[model samples]
Target: MSRHDLQPKADQPHVVRATVGWDRPLQTFFAQVFFRTEDEPDEGEALIWLGTEPGEMLTPEAVIAVVAPHVEMPPDLAERLNAEMRQTTGMKDGRHQAAAKRSLFGSIH
Candidate 1:
């Protein structure tokens, strides 16, 4: 099973977007994460933005390490969001893998 297949279902708020790429100016990977919640879940905020590094898998550990300091989400809730992202996106569903490939390789695949 692909990593995307392990991602959690869309029952609650989850990471809707995750991207990582080269940052020429910074000479490092740039990672971005966007998690969606039902109607202003976080103090009237509908979406949460989190951290990154290019080429590295956007693991929950990484998210916690990077985003936790900036965001004030409960530990359990953050874990849930991380699980959702992993279960949904990390598990490669062929489609996501293709998209990931495109994102990383620029249509080379």
Candidate 2:
């Protein structure tokens, strides 16, 4: 079933749908964010605010902050998500192995 079908009703507080978004840059990698929601989706409204402050970077930590009030996440899920984001960035830059090595054992001298 589609995720939209999983949207929670007022009495079903535990049910949620994951809504994802990304920051658009004029010329660089897009920063992603996601939040789980129980609120009924608005049929014809612009749900996300795309016009962020100039030079604002919506990192995963920022996404968690915005989402904290909306839903509960496992303690490690956010950390995992942030790690995955880092991996994705490295992959996109074609430096996954290098970055992983640096993260694990410091840069090569």
Candidate 3:
């Protein structure tokens, strides 16, 4: 059967899809933060389902905070990530970037 044919019917709970990215070395960290399990696909990436309806997207800082307590990372990494994210997202400074990096990378070393 085709992939669609195998899916649950419309009456079933709707599934939301999201794409998350991380460095290859941080695969386990990402899985732990997002999935709560170490079992991850081999693609070195993750697709998560938050909910059916549109929900507030987690700020990068939020993501970092959620994941930070669970893993080990260097302090500089978090700082650098924050800087990059700030530049990319047009945030005023490293504040949000640091938060997002911490969320994705976990605790700094």
Candidate 4:
């Protein structure tokens, strides 16, 4: 899965979208993550703004790296996903091979 929000509010975000899926053709697992915010357009109305970073293909490790620094994550989960982003960042092709790596999430398949 690939996802990117039009704009992301790292300071005070109101929404977070994250998902994981297997890319059969790529022979790997992929992940997507995005952050957004809600605004009041009128009285008693919440307008969701989808303005954020240009979504791009990121490995599960990369997703966690981006998120961990900006938000408070569960201790166990954060430690796990953030395992190798430091070393693997910007290396998409190599990341795909790490599909068998560990994560807090599991495949439904």
Candidate 4 lands at a TM-score of 0.27
- What are the runs in model 3 whose C-alpha is more than 4 Å off? 1-60, 89-109
Among these predictions, the greatest lDDT belongs to 1
Would you list the clashing residue pairs of candidate 4? 6-51, 6-52, 7-51, 7-52, 8-52
Candidate 2 TM-score to native: 0.38
* Candidate 3 lDDT tens digits, 1-109: 0000022223322312122222212211121222222354322222342211212322334344543443343455445444543444422324664576567656321
Q: Per-residue lDDT for 1-109 in model 2, tens only?
A: 0011123335434334333223222111122223334444333222333324332534545544544454444466546545544544423323664575467547521
Model 2 bad stretches (over 4 Å): 1-16, 20-46, 49-58, 93-109
Error of 4 at 26 (Å): 3.9
TM-score of each: 0.33, 0.38, 0.29, 0.27
Mind giving the per-residue lDDT tens digits that candidate 1 earns over 1-109?
1111122224433644333333221123333545555763443341433332333434545545544433344446445545454444423336665676578657523
TM-score ranking of the models? 2, 1, 3, 4
**Model 4 misplacement above 4 A:** 1-11, 20-25, 37-60, 78-109
In model 3, residue pairs whose N, Cα or C atoms come closer than 3 Å (at least 3 residues apart or on different chains), thus clashing, are 60-100, 61-99, 61-100, 63-103, 64-102, 64-103, 68-106, 73-109, 82-97, 82-98
Which structure is stronger by lDDT: 1 or 4? 1
